[model samples]
Target: MTEPMFWMSVAGVVLAYAGYPAYLVLRRSLDPWPVVPRAWTPPVDVLLVVHNAGDALEAKVANLQRLDYPAQRLTVHVVCDGCTDATAAVARRLASGRVRATVFAERRGKSACIGDLLPTLTGDVVLFVDVRQTLAPHALRALTAALADPSVGAASGELVIRDPTGFAAGVDAYWRYEKAIRRLESATGSMVGATGALYAARRQLIGPVPPGLILDDMWIPLSVADAGYRIVAVDDAIAVDHAPPDPAAEERRKRRTLSGNYQLLHRLPRLALPGAHPLSLRLWGHKWSRLLVPWLLATALASSALLAAAGSRLYLTLFLLQAGAYALAILGRRSAWLAGRFPPARVAAAFLSLNASAALALGDYLRNPRAHLWQTTRYQESGR
Candidate 1:
């Protein structure tokens, strides 16, 4: 084959294997699993790990207190690791008798704090939550009910981005697509991964997370799946939260996530095991492929540009289209005129943004594979 044809063929193969597989996995919502009767009154322990959380602590505690589940059956554990602010005091004052506070004067990582609290958990089910998010009133019940399935090792709630405006609007749109894909993957079998904002699993199925682990959420569910348990996502169980409004703040978050992806790729063997479930395969394709997408995209762009210089109009046209799409996406951020007029172009821009973020993340990963700890960015929530 000619050089231009060869490059196009390579791009086609990569898109088919990586991109098309994701499309198929995310094409449809999973059929609803039979609603299992709540036969067992298992004690539930909700673990909220906070670090220098500001005024949000009170709101989070209040939301938990208002859960529809019986208060007597639910216990909340707030782990304040290395919290310098009034986080511990706030937890103690607000929760009072309703919540238990585990304060570590020294700053161990979040995973280590979880490790310290793991042995102390006496509940049948352990639910993990972040400080900034709140679950729906019936979220606990729905998650617990889903976990009643013998094959399900863990269950995560649907994550809804509460506000979508400005830069966060794009992020919100992306999350909706992500939720749809997870729903489809779950229907086909097990979802690839759960959002850390809210998810629950049998206490016995959780293994001790490594102290250095940055993405405890990913590791916990993967561990459950490795032990032959299915990690399921329940649509009825919903958690609402917002993404960071600032693009730089969002970039920091993605960098940490990508770093964790690298760690998981190196550490998690169950993902590559032969005879792994279809769900596991789907998860592998969905998550890891995205991590490597930026690299692939870079190669495609460079090769296409080179082929275009060598007099291939097809390659040149595709390259120009890609560039124009990104320009329109930037324009979309400025005003509705561009966005409304070019919906397809905006979508392409969104995809390009995702690939760009992934590329930056891969660069960070390459520079320092050992870097794990990260300071959570403080960003304003857009009202839009």
Candidate 2:
């Protein structure tokens, strides 16, 4: 029983990180389901929900105005969510024939703002974007092109974070790894979640997002999948955002995102049930299993430690490896020397940080119901 428990614990951790991606690779190679994107430019509603992003709006709006799509077919809607800053004024000042602005007096979360604004958008496709990131000139066109495939109901653009250093480098490494997984997931079938920084969905396929939802990106894509549509990844559609300047800022952002994973399941329990969701298995393997990894790590450590105490050489070696990795992670957190010198250490440290955040996420969610009202993480604006 003890040996079985130890093996199971190790297997769970391995399967979540290594095994799942391997399965995805094999699945794509054997019975591949590819997205057939074509040249299609439907009417697009470019939506921006800003809180206190007034300083960035001018550049963002200018960037939108430069998109390689038909000006007549593209409209930009900027919703100001109770901005105490100059956000409302800037938005109103930017209003033009193709750009419109709306202001809400109350400080509703982004999800709530999106919900209120979604119904009013009348376009073939709605592209959701953040103010901080600058999209490629052809981003909207690339995103809409994926919607040319009948099975694809939503398309998520890739986010490129530039010039990362220190622990930000580790976070950046993790982001690249995550993007590869999403790309694979898209090629095989649907993405478990979409990139919130830049993603577009068919207007008819999406419904109003629930208020106070932290992960509207996840909710939106999963909802489209529930309606029997594929959520694709558009590699050519890029939104460039700079890496957070501070390691703590990156950790906070990660914690909030991890917390949202819990909130997602609570809000949409049907997604976990096989009978209710078509992509339940994928969701479990990709998202839910990851949530359990911290606990699995804890279990593996405890079980192996116990077995090692009983003089088992195999368990002792496993325990040493785990301990050394964590020690390196701790060292990596304090100083960037090891990770800067060793790329693998950078990723490992980042992976450990993520799992730690996932473990803490539940506490954050339970203690603060208003955790959805996010404080924006600071990052420099990236060009092109």
User: Which one wins on TM-score?
Assistant: 2
lDDT of 1: 0.73
Q: Clashing residue pairs, candidate 1?
A: 30-187
The sequence of per-residue lDDT tens digits that candidate 1 reaches over residues 1-384 is: 346554665565476345644565545433444434354557899898888885678788788888888889899998887888888898777665558888889876778888889889999999898877777998998888888888888888988876555556666667777777666656655666788889998999898787867788888887787777877778888888775665556657877786777777667655655466444556556776576666655666677777789998998987787567667767765554554465654455456666677777766777764455556555453111
Model 2 TM-score on a 0 to 1 scale: 0.96
Q: Tell me the whole-model lDDT of each prediction, alpha carbons only.
A: 0.73, 0.88
TM value for model 1: 0.87
Q: What TM-score against the true fold does each predicted structure earn?
A: 0.87, 0.96
Question: Which candidate number has the best lDDT?
Answer: 2
How badly does each model clash, as a count of residue pairs?
1, 0
Give lDDT tens digits, candidate 2, residues 255-324.
8998998888888788788778878888888889999889989988998999999999999999999999
After superposing all C-alphas onto the true structure, candidate 2 shows an RMSD in angstroms of 1.7
